[model samples]
Target: VLTGFASRYAEPESQTITIVKDNLKAVPARDFNLGIEYGAVYTIKRPDSWEIIYNGTIVNSLHEPVPVKNLTLYFEDFDEFVEIATIDTDENSNFYFNYTKYGNIEQNPLVRIMYKGDGLYNPLDHIEYGGIEMGADQNWWFYDEDGDGWPEWPFTLYDLFAALQIESSPTTSDLSVYLAWMAEFNENSGTSTFDIVSNLEGLLKGNTSWTSGRRDSGLLFDGDGIITPPQSTGFVKSVQYKELVFSTSDVTKSIALDVGTNISNTIPFVTIKENVGDDWDDIMVDVYFTDSPATVYAQRSTSGATITVSIFIVEFDDVKVKVQSGTFSNTGTFAEETISQINTSKAIPMAYYKASGGDDDWDASMVTTDFTDTTTIRMERHGSSGTMSGHYYVFEAQDSEFSVQKAVLSMSSSQGYDTASINSVNMSKSFIVSSYESDRANDDPEDGALDVFLNSATEVRAERHSETSYFNGFPTINVFVITFTGAESVQRGDFTWANSDTFKETDITAVDLGSSMIKSGNMYGIMQSDGTGSSDVKSAFVQHEFVDTDTIRLERYTNNEDGKGHWEVIEWELMSSSPAVYEDFDYLLWNDILDNVFGNTSNQFVVTSWIYPTALTSNQSSNNVKNVFFSKDGMIEIGINESGYLELFLSTDLVQTTARYGIEGLIQTNEFTYIAIRYNESDVDIFIDDFWYRSAVGSIGEPWSGSVNITSGGDLIIGAELIKYSSFTGKLDDIS
Candidate 1:
């Protein structure tokens, strides 16, 4: 009987339905379920021009339709999913709603189509196909996380959607947790979303709480955490303090401090305060650092009575210190340490050279010892000749045991009637004898001798002189003895003239008197003549006739037959005097000494001098800049440009890979200016008048190598270069 009833009632038939309104077109409905309530699932075909609206503006759109299914048609509000029909798309890709006969329809009503997935779309995934007011306040916006054209609503039903997808009760009160859960849901699903939701639940339940304490206490949450003070706390990393006490008799006080660790690269802030007795005014205080284990000096005023000095150092490491008091300029010394202990090994083996006018060039001969023993080093200069001039030089081993030697000479002279000779001489070294003689009757005029051999290295004797007159008259002679040793050289002349008969205007000339060695000073000599008869006798006198750098003249007296004396022939003898021309810009060139001093090694050095620029050179070319000091081949130079700018250049090679620093208008005419240049590797610093002027970075070359033979091919030139015409036109002093 049931078979017959089934056969009599036909099976529910499926049908297709198409819905289109305005610009909205849905997928055709198919295979409608008739008997069961909410039986069929349906899908709406996405519009050909479907757009993603965000805050009243369309952010993105799909120009083509998409097949959608399992869509639940809802009425009115979004959360009220009272479905009048459940719709889905069939094989034709058309959506159909299963309409129950008792369902009611409202015209142009607000609706929200809810889509739940059947292996394709997840629940809570929905689209508003119609009834969305244009320009209305948007409660949701579309966000494309992966740029896939298909956008997801960022916060649309975000909490409910997250709960439904995660299948966990995550609190929605915390917006951060909710947003995090939404992100996890959209980007990752299944186990990933579940894990995120579980962690968020734990975070909400375990809430953050402040621990009941100060300083050492922190935040108490699911796990203990460190608490950092806010920026307003004004925290200090480290600090150091020191105090110095001084008595009425004390002129100065110092304190030593150890900053615990090396703070070489860090800048420290230092402050000092002084407190003297009420009767005394403010005292001066100075804070400084001294090497040899790196000590800090906190000094107090010397004049105040019972003063206290307070020193504060901040931003340094933990340190401890000691205080000391003493008189001014009498600060006690620190214990000496080896060079290596104080990181001064590089400064050892230091060399210095100084040169003045008329001094010999500095060379390897100046350095008596190697760097290993600085005490043995020495420097000496060949003494000046022909002039008493201001020329001196000093070279010694700094901070070492060394001494310099000087040469001293003792000399004497004698004279006779017609001959001259050196009587006796005592010298520290070998000596030379110079003599002059004149005989009128013998036809001998002024005569001079030089470089005569001494009897001994330290002492010399002159043979007794005897002169026979041609006319049976007494002879006359004169001699000069000059002894020299240890780099001392000088020139001297002695003259003797005699005549028996009255003579007139006889010209006498001296020869080979060592004129090149002459020095200007007083002249001394002797003159005598014989008388014919008692009535014919006359007084004898010597007259300085004329003088030059190399020669001098003396006129002798003669008696006439009437007993009247007159001037006779003048005698010309050689004398010493200074050379006429001495240039102010004259320079000294030390051949190839740079190579011996600074070889192809790396070095940090400073060059400093006080210069008075009296004049600028006529040459305006940059290449013709006046050189105050320089190394041959231009490896290092301190010069003035055409514009009177002081320039410094340090090169690795001859005119190659050089670093240059300069200051405009650094040199003022006729004014003394202090200039200094410090060079380390590729960095160059220029200072003028003790203030920083300019700097250059990079390209400072390697030190000149001794193998380059600067002594032969180049030189450390002062005032000018060997091949260049440029020369400094001013005075230079205290150059280092």
Candidate 2:
């Protein structure tokens, strides 16, 4: 038996055949018996690309034949490894065919097998088999588990868990069996690299019964609002907490206190002690950053009497936070302004205020009323005394770590303590209290015992004692409470720090955040201010800001001689608990079918998609950072360029010539938009939502008129360039 090739037409012509092998001679096409056991024969059409006899089998995990019968066979051409054709398998779960090999015999052939399982078996993931020996047989065993073919089930507990597909949830009530999904954790690395989703739109309840005098705990969520097991902790870690005290008399309108801590990446909370000898009037006190390191500027609205204030600063190592700080100048009795920084709807907002401008600006009683819709702050300005211009800070509130509460309590007697309950306050945490008179009644100084303290975890008590007259009146107090927890994404700590004695800048290099995970919008911090010493309280001012991701630079606006320096910094960040849409290097790749999709013609064709873009530029390590959309390298690309222009690129021979058609400011980040790229035979038109930009007939030139050969070098890629790691950080849907 011999094997060779021949012409398809039966023509009477004399043909000379040459055989290179010495042992075997070429057989005539009519006399050659191409049939062999477990093999089949086919004609080789071209010299460069030829066909070979290939066979394979499908089986279950137990190596038994997949009894479901006919299955489709996908062939991946060796030239591009793209799915070339689909054939069928026989009843025995075996397939035999003459597979075409692209390029040459030096390049191995490949086969991609995929099975859409029947009712009794789960479907198989596409398995690509390559590097087949020239003469050896090829066989594959598919693990067909017993289940409906939707989400492929893991073969063992050690297998990486992906997703679960179900037609319906269990109907029986009080079912005891646990339905759990888990990812694999690498013991050596101490991390789980698998990505999966656990979503329950329905009610999720804990175990109903705990017999034997035991009780089962309900669901628990972490600081990121992610459901976690009871044993898990490491969400929020407290580094340290420090309370600093200082005195700022009316003669000293502003004082810079040093809390000898790295105030670079921290949030500061200040409360001034009530001036017992002063009259009922609006008091303004604020904490600010100075150029001085480890120092914060404390300021009141006016200067006349002596008063003491305490600064509470918290430093957090790992927390999710958002902070917005700016000065608001208002001449009216009330003002409501929108803050774009506080964008999330899930968390509350905590605001701090300090009067700015002239001493007259501090006369009117200005208070932070409420943060509504999480983005707008309402400030109630009473007492037509002066304009209220000051610095305001709004931070995303996480109740477990820190919170600020305001309450109005009136003292009926002049010498007793009147208590009011503060709802939802954790009883086990520490508190800092500051009070001020806000009646706008008079400016006459009245001597009385005015002090406030935490009577209990949920209640606060105040005392008022008058020596000459009954100075009994209602006063508003702002309470600052801080708690430390081991299960939130916050870091709190303190360090000894001092500012430049002679007004200069101090720098802290690489604030030890335990990790280099700091970004612009996710991290915020506040620090406390304490005078240089207990006796000397001098007027001081300081400012601090982040230089980069990890550095903080502080500058002192005023000179200081001697004062107490105790500082505390609180830092927090926001984390994503759900599965990420797309990471830096993640993308999607498709077969080289752009030629088929667009065809070899200058005809009007439209391509469109609904995209929710987190960013218009790529965040990966590649030279093609601007290609944050779709790309078929060397042929065509559609993405935002480095100049933020939404452009479509077409090239005939990319190494020699290319053309680009784009529009500026049409695409934006953090927005959902419908984008369409239309080529109307003559010119190109791009539509972002209802807005369209047309490059008329001769403006940006025409789309490539004929077939741009799709080569083996690259295929169509979504979310990134073909040969690099430039990936789009967003969600995409309905591409056509």
Per-prediction RMSD in angstroms? 35.3, 24.8
Worst 10 residues of 1 by lDDT: 385-394
| lDDT by residue (tens digit), candidate 1, 398-493 | 221111221222122233212223333333222221222112222111111111223333333322223322123122211122322213233233
Clashes of 1: 39
* lDDT, candidate 2, 1-736, per-residue tens: 2346644545587989964311111111121121111111222324455544334555666555554344444444435445444555557555565565566442233445455666556665444334211111111111223323111222121111112222123222121132222111111121112211232121111111111110111111110112222332233222322223334344223343444543433455443433222221223445555555555555555554344443444433234444555556556655677877444422233334444333222124435344555567655544445555555555544434355554545554243345667765544333332323334233321212234455565776554332325443344434333443422232112222243342222333344343212111000111122322311112222222334544543333222322111112224332224422322244444445445434444244455555555555434323333545666555556666544556555543212123444445656665555566665444456665533455422343544544333222256555556344444555544344
lDDT at position 20, candidate 2: 39
lDDT of 2 at 315: 36
Q: Give all TM-scores, in the order shown.
A: 0.19, 0.32
| Per-candidate local distance difference test | 0.32, 0.39
Give the Cα-based TM-score of candidate 1 against the true structure: 0.19
Error of 1 at 347 (Å): 70
Q: Which stretches of candidate 1 lie over 4 Å from their true place?
A: 1-585, 594-597, 618-624, 653-662, 696-713
Residue-pair clash count for candidate 2: 64
